[model samples]
Target: MHALPDIVGYLAAIIGTICWIPQTIKAWTTKETKDLSIWANILVLLTITLWFIYGILIGSIPLILGNLISICAVGAIVIAIFRFRSQ
Candidate 1:
């Protein structure tokens, strides 16, 4: 019933979250932040955080877990951007 749909949702979340890792790693390794907009990433983080909270409220493991993992990647990039950004 709900199992198949839930599995699909989780799979989608996993794919979406995985997409951010390469960018995060690239940014971290290259120490390049000029092209990356801090505000945009911050907004993304905010949205994800809100979604994570919503997932918590709704008791959706996929949403909670996906956002949790995504936030790590995003948070790393954000920190790297701040750390490596040119003055």
Candidate 2:
């Protein structure tokens, strides 16, 4: 059924979004982002933003929700990188 695929999509989105939690937590708590690449994070943010836009265009709730959350998670990492940059 159509509902089953949407359920799967939502599940995947949730798991994927959650994957960033540990990294975000570590970056914020330790205040250490030296090992993290700013460019990579920025690129990821950009990529997710595009996906979010595409999701909106297609009206896919799962994609929209997932990418929206990803943007926040990755955006936080980017902020952490700048805020905690090594002196």
Candidate 3:
């Protein structure tokens, strides 16, 4: 069965999703994304969006949930990038 693979995917997803938290927290606390590139963020968002779509198409729970959470986490960072720009 594919259960093992799916479980692995979920574990991987959890790790990937957690990877963004530190950056997000730093951005939120410092209110700085001055060094971050908008293009890079956009590209990352686009890639994640595609993954989310793919997950939907395949009906993989791990892919779906992981990417959804990732979208929100990374999305927050992107929003913060725009929201906390230095004047």
- Against the unseen true structure, what C-alpha lDDT does each candidate score? 0.90, 0.89, 0.84
lDDT order of candidates, top first: 1, 2, 3
Off by over 4 Å in 1: 1-11
TM-score of 3: 0.81
Tens digits of per-residue lDDT, candidate 2, 17-52, equal 778878888999999899899999999999999999
Worst 10 residues of 1 by lDDT: 10-19
Candidate scoring better on lDDT of 1 and 2: 1
Model 1: what TM-score?
Answer: 0.84
Indicate the worst ten consecutive residues by lDDT in candidate 2. 10-19
* N/CA/C clash count, model 3: 0
In order of TM-score, best first, we have: 1, 2, 3
Highest-lDDT candidate: 1
- Which parts of model 3 are misplaced by more than 4 Å? 1-11
Candidate 1 lDDT over 33-85, as tens digits, reads 88999999999899999999999999999789889999999999899899998
Q: How close to the true structure is residue 24 of candidate 2, measured as C-alpha lDDT? A: 87
Residue-wise lDDT of candidate 3 within 1-87, one digit each (tens)?
899999998688779867877888898888989997878877887888899999999897777787888788789889998998763
**Judged by TM-score, which candidate is best?**
1
